[model samples]
Target: MIIVIVALGGGVAGGYALSYQQAQQSVLKTSVPKELAPVIAAYETVTNNYYKSVNTTKLTDGAIKGMLATLDDPYSVYLQNNDKTNLDDTISASFGGIGATIQQNHDSLSIASILPDTPAKKAGMQVGDVLLKVNGKDVSKQTVSKAVAKIRGKIGTTVAVTVKRGSKQATFSMKRQKITVDTVTGQLASANKQVGVITISTFSEPTVKQFKATVKKLRKEGAKSFVLDLRQNPGGMMSAALSISSMFSKNGQTVLQVEDRNGAKEVYKAGKKLDDGFKVTEKTAVLIDGNSASASEITAAALHQNSNIPLVGEKSFGKGTVQNVGEMGSNKELKLTIAKWLTPNGTWINHKGLTPDIKVDYPAAAKITLINATQLKPGDKGSDVKSLQQMLTALKVGSVTVNSQYDDATQAAVKTFQQANKLDATGTADQDTLATLAQKLSAQLTKDDPMMKAAVDAVAK
Candidate 1:
């Protein structure tokens, strides 16, 4: 009997007898017993029909690519010759393209971030920018891989991209080049302040070296309190995560723990030279969001569990599984899940993400009223007037006298502060009033607090 299968826009026919006999002989070589012949024969009969139809054509490159696509796993698709070369170059950290991270959103694609000092950043591409068209063609209907192919090209080539940022649509003609992204970025949080912020985009091959150098530089700049931003970091090398965690930990401490499939557990410890010159400050905070994963989680967990550091922002995307890339012959590779990782305290933060120690949400609407306070206008009344004037003066609303008076200056100053902080601007500190007042007071106190003052005062120390 003959069976025909159609795929990749082509059709081929193969004889069942010939394909089945070949599968049986191949299985027999694997030492299958005679009693299992019927079961093995049945399995091969179905697979043979599929395989033969795939190999029916002159065994061209298209057949192999099509066969892999039938698997329907995005990460399991076969890379074309050119794509294979590009993949190698990307993992090697050298690629010719506009420097941007992209992710598939629904049917369209969006820019996750534009790397600093790259063409995309120079061209003004921002996060949440929805890619609508590429080279004058509608990209809203294209797959992520198809759009990537359209966007990436030879060095010095130019590609036009149209994106929608919020309600505004803009086009940018970006010139592609060999972009090498610095996985680490560091700077003093506020030059006058002694706080430092370092943003690690990924735990790539060079991350450990880069992170060490960055910390040393920041420390020299009088950075006493640090904010390590792993907000959108998706993670990379495991060794890099261990090395990074070591910078903040003392010797003979476990950074993270891993459990293999057979229930075997291993604890990864900080090296003897860990924290060589960097002092672990008690006020360190790790910034994380939904995108931070894998190695980033490992670092965050280590700090939160074993140290005094606090984690801020939203929960992370928990991907604690360790994957081992196995080379299957013929230039193919299989990335298989091997083990799961736990925090130093033995919490399995997989699927269920790491919760923040402090959760703060950005205000969602402009119409939200924060504060409420009633006052008399210029040329007004008695006891109420005295109370209003006193409150306004206390809030630094104006320089006007508060002796049982209602004045225009006080109301004007109140309105200015309200509007500046995105409040209702009614000149009344309404429902949202106390929170704003508290925040202002906190900020003021933080600036002159004895701890911060001492840290800054010891610039020579």
Candidate 2:
């Protein structure tokens, strides 16, 4: 038996479906088509007559990519090695590793955030710690993706990580655990305790279960109305979406329509097969942003069209096509667009995102750029310095002027921020300083997120 994973949305973040079928004979046993003879001839000529020994695998991968390029579809791609591993980790939303989000700006990689109760947090790995080595391999100059590849391994395996925290260096060794990320988070809205705000980051296989559990728990906490936040959710498994959409839909209600290449349409509905019969009868509102796509769009549209739930925020990320991911072994995979998905009303959102019923844009502070300068002293002057100054001004760190020059005022403000945040008061914007500044700015912006406020207001009304 062969199993294929079908998906919808942007490549990395999309809706997925599992399909099982009998394994077919390999194409190698069959005769080649006449049209592919030229390809075979080119391959033979390259390997047999080339000036140097040819890497057959490289030639094969390039040919596959060239064929996919003709489709001009970004979702349809050939992933190799680290890219393939990243995709699998993203889809599963679980991995065996020290749980932390690594960020790479320029040549430096550092811990962006550590998941709670994970090995990284339990091992006392703090944010902004500059990654120096992973398992004795230097990753200070590697990209975040490569660093993550090195950090992840089989569960129960021990890995050593050395990082520079402030002016000191520390090493931690911990056994990797199978970390299942909590994609769905819920709490009573701070503005309105009666309103439960549930945010689904992505639609993974475990997302539906997590969402249900959150809803149940929130309902017990005196939540009357609800806010479903799908902002920045790139979508996930189709089963999860349908099951979640069903929570607000009646049994047998149309959830979405899938049309294959042959133009045959299949309707998916909320019932025993796709839904678990759990329903949310409270008044609800949905929040969507430009990054909400595929399964996110599906659930948003379902709630809006089925139960008249209002969608608040900017337009969604338009992505309605479905893909099938085929494993080709050798740490490679081929993701190909296979079908088109539509809303219950049969609207194709491909390239045309769903318009929110109530549009609310993010505040300017939310767009504050990150400081990427490795170090900025009193004499530095550049765009990076300007960004630091701008962030400082926006954060109201001090009465510092927003300019390209990192003068004495900027240094004083940086020092003040460092002292307040418990960081070393170096008076210079180093990696630790810059990362802390970014995190603080982000936290402040999130506290006053206008979109979240809008969603709560919509639910209240």
Candidate 3:
């Protein structure tokens, strides 16, 4: 009588929330354990005899969390309203918002990135602008999730956001729209135009469509081979993985296998229709890193086993369990592990990841620490300050000491960077300054990505 929401492209296929009748029926069919009589008595005693007022909602949520905590499983979680909404948005890959990703560091929430053609970009919202308020309500102390929930709303509605950039605060009122994330992006390799590199960040409903179009476009542009990069990809929809695998597999070929606790198994096969009437027969090499998991592993295993495609880069993140998300009333959700999944060869990669056919590690410099401070003054001292100093050194803004302490030399270097980037010449590294530094560092990393090089070399033959 347990409820389950089948994962369809990482999202629920029908209504998200369970109906009252369904919940009632499930509860009515199951008899409450007589062993819980003492637990119920404890609840009555606490509520009836407590000296101060109590929030029953918090009590109930805590009880639910405690129950889940006993399972000792990280995947099974009791999600609050905002957390549930965020997970749903991520799975669907679409949401009604200004289309900006936010990040929080040391109690400061700021814009991490902005999607192109979105209301946030149109309204001139720049990265690193520290969020101050939403709709005239102060949200400076709220968490990133709560603040984001405040920003997202029904499509066509307006949300006013106030952000602090440098020394001034600006408020922008913009209409929210449906922001569809592009999970798949492809481009012809600069070193070899005949080789196309496609990166799948995450799997979602639009992933298959986007992948099909990308393949078609690359082939039209004279790309004879492809490097499918799944590095840093935390897997999403199982449906997307199956559909994408079908593009390189024969019709009716096995893509994945699911087994429940009862030892019963379900076989998932590739469909010709899911291939969009075409087969990608070109030489393709998959690039996986330690972060690639679930759907990413499924696609990699399917292509490697079925088409004999070589896998390059490091081993994948092993995640072989399947989860079913059931929506509780009041915007809450219970995500529980339901079954285990196996690769095409019947290997369960629960904690042991797939070994790459060719392993290539990135350079040590690729592990550069990110700047996590909202601002850094001359007296500040931490790893973040050290990172800023290193970035300033790499950019050749000015000669500064690489020590963790932010001294006068660091301030001068920051000022020089600000002036060169056409920003306010503030000696302190502010949000805007930090964002610019991060972007510059990212560009350098992309140019020297060793994994990309290995992937291109593998498939460019």
Which ranges of candidate 3 are over 4 A from the true structure? 1-30, 52-57, 82-145, 150-180, 273-277, 377-382, 396-401, 405-412, 426-428
Question: If scored against the real structure, what TM-score would every candidate get?
Answer: 0.59, 0.76, 0.72
How do the candidates rank by lDDT, highest first?
A: 2, 3, 1
Q: Write the per-residue lDDT of candidate 1 for residues 205-288, one digit (tens) a residue.
A: 667777878877888987776778786576767877887787677666789888998989988887645444444543677877
List model 2 lDDT by residue over 65-177, tens digit each: 89888898867877765445122133113668877666443336666545445677555565567899997789997755687878888889988787886655655666789
User: Among these predicted structures, which one has the highest lDDT?
Assistant: 2
Cα RMSD for candidate 2? 11.9
lDDT of 3 by residue, 164-229 (tens): 876656566677899868767888998899999888767767788889999989989989999998
The window of 10 residues in a row where model 2 has the poorest summed lDDT is 15-24
How far in Å is the alpha carbon of 273 misplaced in model 1? 7.6
Model 3 residue 70 CA deviation (Å) reads: 1.1
CA RMSD per model (angstroms) = 13.3, 11.9, 11.4
Model 1 residue pairs with clashes = 370-431, 370-432, 370-433, 371-429, 371-430, 371-432, 371-433, 372-429, 372-430, 373-429
Q: Give candidate 1 regions above 4 Å deviation.
A: 1-18, 31-96, 101-114, 117-133, 136-158, 161-178, 273-282, 362-461
C-alpha lDDT of candidate 1 relative to the true structure? 0.62
TM-score of 1: 0.59
